[model samples]
Target: MAPPTTTNSWQHPSPHLTRVDAFRRQVNRRYGLSLETYHELLRWSVTELEAFCRELWTFCGVVCSAPPERVAGPDDGALDRMWPRPNWFPGARLNFTENMLAAGLAAHPDAVAVSACREGGAAWRHLTWARLRDETARYAAALRSLGVGQGDRVAVVTTNSVEALLVLLACGSVGAIMSSTASDMGAKGILERYLQIRPKVLFVESRVVYNGKTHDHREKLGGVVAQLRKAVAELEVVIDVSGSSWSDGRIKSLDNFLDVRTESLRFAQVPFDHPIYILYSSGTTGPPKCIVHGGGSALLQQKKDFILGFDLGPDSTYYQYTTTGWMMWNYLISALSLGARIVLYDGSPLYPSPDYQVQLLQEQGVTHYGTSPKFLAALKQAGIKNMPPLDSLQMTLSTGAPLSAEIFEWFRSIFPSKVGLVSATGGTDLVAGIIGGSPLLPVHHGELPAPSLGMAVEIWDANGKNIEDTGEKGDLVITKPFFSMPITFWGEGGEEKYRKAYFDTFPGVWHHGDFVRKIVKTQGYEVLGRSDGVLNPGGVRFGAAELYGIVDQFSEVQDCIAVGQRRKLDADEQVLLFLKVKTPPLSDGLRDRIRTTIRKQLSSRHVPAHILEVQDIPYTMNGKRIENLVKDVVCGRTAKVGGTAANPESLEEYEKFVDLPLVQSSAKL
Candidate 1:
């Protein structure tokens, strides 16, 4: 837990470049080779993963109908046929919303493909790409006149706008699977994730706005459509996006669930591992694990992390503050498959104040924003120095948690030095990013500027060897199998819950429970967060994101979590920390300057025996940081708190830290 030094602060020079050096000089002139660095085209994209996915499916023009004669097939005979599962694009039929409405109507059928707004600053709305493909072809002809189709399952619940991206492009243009969540979850976490995907069409959201309050989910959508029509007997229709007069016999309304003479929009080609979306698993400490995801491997791994990791094309706009229950809103609507407009705010990126999402990312010029790390530590504790220069902001990203090298040097001291502040860390079981950001490398303040092209990702240890060139700190795994992995995990022992959630710790590799490292003087990758919430204490392991990057550089901390408790006759693990304080009763010289700034920036075995203030810091409805449900309510256990928890009453203030006195300490170092 000690590798931080490496500081180029930010680089990207080479004959001045960006579309990842025009996709590494179009993979060095279409693979003649001699790839000069994005770490040698990410080590020739994880060792020639089928010629780097057939040159990333012909450099993302991917509107496949039957293209793959084979871009990776082998394995599947198992008995460790070298970690099996490799069949991406074997006879691919495609149609993830017809390659995102044929790349947004062949790149800009009158531009603006979905702009949106809604929480307190309303009137923005837009849509365009021929009105989002004629409102997803009248919601895919009203879900095929309510018979739904091709592997069904719809869902929704809503709110991330433009009618939840036209119900996920009308359930991926009828190959159907969708599953969404936000509209602030609960009706028992939207019937524990649409009663495990029995969803034959739900949609919902009769009112939701946020931080400036609105929320009238018509009595929680009539008790979640009467307990999902008595536990999903294949539900068969609900709709209601906004115009909910509560009629029950299978409800209706967004203009009687639109069919508008079904104005053309076909696309159901199907099979490249069909399914489509679903994505759950933050069931805090129970249920939730739906996962699924496929549609040509979530459209060729979110169009290769949005055209070579965030250089997103066709005049990129993006935005991503997320929540149609977060997989970054399914990686921000795959930025309309790269005809990129996106934006969709919906609510509270600190609603009416706190720089209202940096004035809506400088009045929506937003060239690829996506945020988190507690919104750059609440804009560096609201001192908010200067950020409105924006100038078509390039890349910012940051994922649900762990971004801190003091919030990437306070977001490079208030933005735009040619943006690129990335910091990703994949999750919702590989929706994307197994480590991220690359616009041809070198951003290094708190790492992660690599390991994502075809992600073989590494750093192992704790017996499963490969500790990524010994910069030590381990587990993040992956080892191979790319193209967005989750085509499983729904119910009925889903292949033993997808090999016990990622190959039961390394047998066939993909472990990814986080705790990474690989800095080796800046090859760049640092995560250090959830290796099952790492911590340990006396036995000294680390990463509650390295004590919330030294208690979030305290401007009297407005949030913090850090866990590891151990109780019931504990022999070690103590470390608690809590703190939710933007001014609270936490004094004692600000808890001895947050334990002397975690013993002077991470050491005294990473401090914390118990610092406690807590007024709220549970998080998960995609803003992550529940630290193993506050370390299972400080080790006394019984935690359960799930409904996607954006504060399940902040887990009852960590159950009073299981009767404190540092969990009945037996005085020892």
Candidate 2:
């Protein structure tokens, strides 16, 4: 396939004045190299990682007590372990929270650090840098009073508010690992994640409001507390952020829990690879994997992404619509390191109305607005044609799923031309993107602008051969260990589990499980959905995104999912397309148009064997489609609905197709 012609929609007026270009010039001068362009600088970064990382650390002005003796440790002479997991910044000692607050406290103590809003609220509340630091200090003192120290786990069940940020900062300051999930998660889901880490202290919200509805979690909290106390012998206390009048003796209000003293805020300096956060997998298929991330690594990688990838600064207002459960929420908090004001919204993006959300973005003067494809699709379906001119809005980011070309083009038509629409692909496993947009690159129609700096990204076929330049779809693999790679998995056999998850298929490469294609001409990447969910028919494999890209162009289709179904007697897997129409009923004419459009745009093998309209499509709690789970049910396998599924009942609609009869004859359109 040929790459689409690129257009220069957004570019720096003066190349030398851009932030990345300036960084490149500085690196060239320091290293005595003649790198000319941004692409050349990226090549240098991946090839000469030691010098690049050392320069980046100094450029970001990381607050460290002591610098590393060397960038990376010497190779241990193990072939399989050489590139898979390289030790970075050995003998360095720093605290994540200290680095985050250093710039803000020193330069902008009175500036607004966080702006937040609750569901259906009319006003936004601001938290200044001084207040953030003071509150975090108080929380740290409180945790210390409870004997929370290094390597301990502190779990939170809360909303996206200032309180969540405070808890994360406090835990990171004391070297305690922080993990949190949104209030909407069921008790089972919450336990499945927290139980693995066995947190010593738990933070809970008494109540949460979403879509203009208040949900009381008192009874659910009681059950969880009882179960956790029995399961984890180390559990000591539970803190309530809402100050609810609960009768439980173990629960304490926020005011009572804080043990304010005359001591100043102290940061516990730990090793470079010390665990600071424990992020969980989606847990749609089975139990969620507890992946631990290093403090120094997460800080450096996220700062690089925010500073260079998004061009965030002290004056920039960063807003990412995320709950505590998603990795994007963690990424959003990293903006504090740059002293950028972060916006937190705790509600459905489509609540009240799509226009209401748009108005909030414009009114907040959001410079970097992070969002998802579903939100954009909803806005397009609602016929929202006009929006207020957002002069401050520079970029709009989309993740969690693939963004179709139809919606991308539609969004481009409605949004300001200067605002670059960036579609990035990453996961909880890496804590950052492998391929994303850059401030210096031009935005393509439906492709990520470039691979992230310092990441050796490649597309490999089934035989572990690079196929990126050939324009063929294959597994997304990182050829070298990156800064944000998980330190380890929790519990017994942690090393084995970590190795099996990413390094089992390829001996030393990190298989990210995403099926992707690179456009050779444009040098952009297209993430076709997950590799495990790839559909195979007549020995040709393709991702579900290819089918959805074609069918989404129709105005009548609201949303859809494509899966592969193969029973015991079938020789080849059959492609099944399920649609949730905007109207009550889908007409036969629309089905024919869908089939014909797919066959014309893609190949005949891409056409679905059956096109059926359904009431709804299943998605994970993080808003990712459950294609692999649906495929299991349609292939005569028992699908165990997990806590991560947002709407598990939607899977029952596809169970009837398990015994579907094979087509007697191929019908020609």
Candidate 3:
């Protein structure tokens, strides 16, 4: 296989002025060595992992009460082999909230820390650093008054708004573990997650507006609280952020619940390994796993990512289009720790117009914007060209799904050439990116430029052999331990379960479950798709993203899903491609054109046995294609549609294809 010959699109104007470059100089001074290039720094970072973490903590300006006893504890050979889990920063005492708010409050109390807005391009509401600190104190005092304290769990079913972030910080201030999901999730979905942790206090929104529709969720909230109380014996209070009536005795309105008199803020210092947040896995196929994260590691990793990975500083304004449920929300708010203002937006990005987000970015003077590939696809399909010249924009990031080559080229055509487009790949498992952008490097089209500084990212074959330099697709594995690894999955046998989920595949290394191939010529990596979702048609393995990358070039494709199917009578799995076509519906000519292109570009072995048209495609709430669910339905297995789905009903259309004549005929081969 040959790498594409496309030139790098964007490069830093002054690399020496960037934060990462400054940090590199600081490291060189401390170590008394000269390391010039980014790749050299990367090699040193992974080889001396503990020293790299120590340097990150110092350079990132972490606010701590006590210094760490040691940089990091010794690794027990394999990551899964350790009996007692090793902590990253041993004997350190710090508060996550203090680290997030202290620097901003100290430097400029009057500066805007948060700019909040809702759908329809509403007027932005700004919260200054001083006000945010004061409000967080009051909320923390209120939580203490309600008997919530350190090690206790506080959950929320809320929208992405100012009040929600206030409660999150307040919980962190008092050393309580915070867990949250989006308001759009149904009662069953929310309960499925919250019931596992059994939080002492639950905060929920009364109403949510999206796509210009206001939905009153009072009835649903009442039912959810009722069921929650029955199962969760620790449940004590349910506070509604929005002003809404509640008949339940445990429920309290926000105004009544808040303690307004207290104005002084205090941060409870906990050990380095103390739990800060509990995030859940997508429950598409089964029950969601409750993953707990440590404060010190989360803070260090996020700060490193922001300061070095994206070159964010105090002057930068950051906005990430996300919901409360996604990890990007947590990632977005971390910008405040660097004295940068973060935008908290609620509701749909497409409301009113497709270009509303661009208008908001222009109005707010956002330098760094984080978004998903789905949003870019929407803008492309809507024919949004002639975009206003966004002079203030510096970088645009894409995650949540693979950024196809076509979308990458289209994005370059629309946005300013000076604005770098970064395609990053990571997971909610780690609250930071594994392979993300570098300020010193040039931005390449459709490829992740570099591995995250502290992450030892590599590709491995089925035999556990390192295949990164071969340009052949393999499983993405972390060969060493990093700070941001989750503390543990929350439950009995959590350590064992965590090991099984990440380490069982390779017996030592952390198998990230992503199929990837490193581009040998450019040293950039391309995420193919989920390793578990890899298509194995007639014993040839490949990711669905490879097929989508080719099919997406066609203007007729609105959306598509490719999966491998095998029935009880079939001899081998056959590849099936389902297309959600735009107006002229998928004609035989168009199908032949797609098939011919796939056979020509990729080999004949890569072509799908059938190209069927569908009315719609299913996606998760985070705008990811639910390939596993579709594969399950088409294989004649019952699909256990979970709460993570944005549109589960769209899956019913795929049920008829279970007994496809073409699939049955493949068995005769």
RMSD of each: 22.5, 2.7, 2.8
Q: lDDT: which candidate is best?
A: 3
Per-model TM values vs. the true structure = 0.34, 0.96, 0.96
lDDT-wise, the better of 1 and 2 is 2
Give lDDT tens digits, candidate 2, residues 51-130. 78888888877888888877777553322243447677888999999988988878889999899998654457898999
Q: How many residue pairs clash in each candidate?
A: 1, 0, 0
**Cα lDDT of model 3 overall?**
0.86
Model 1 quality (TM-score): 0.34
Worst 10 residues of 2 by lDDT: 1-10
* Candidate 1 residue lDDT tens string, 1-669: 212223337654332356766877888887687787778888888777767778788878888768776665654332122244666677778888878767778866997888887875587878789988887888888888888878888888888888878878888888888888888777788788788878887878878768877778788779888888887888877878788577575688888778457668888887787888888888877678898988888778888888777778878888888878888888888778878788887888776766778778788788778888887787778766455888887778888777878888877766766666878888878777777877666677777877778787888878998978878898888776787788778888876888877888778777878888887877787888878888776666768887778777777778878788887777777778888787778898989877887777666777777787878887777777778877887788888776777768868767867867654322333
- What is the full ranking by lDDT, best candidate first? 3, 2, 1
Steric clash pairs (candidate 2)? none
Residue ranges of candidate 2 with Cα displaced over 4 Å:
1-15, 74-84, 121-123, 664-669
For each candidate, what is the lDDT? Answer: 0.78, 0.85, 0.86
lDDT of 3 at 561: 94
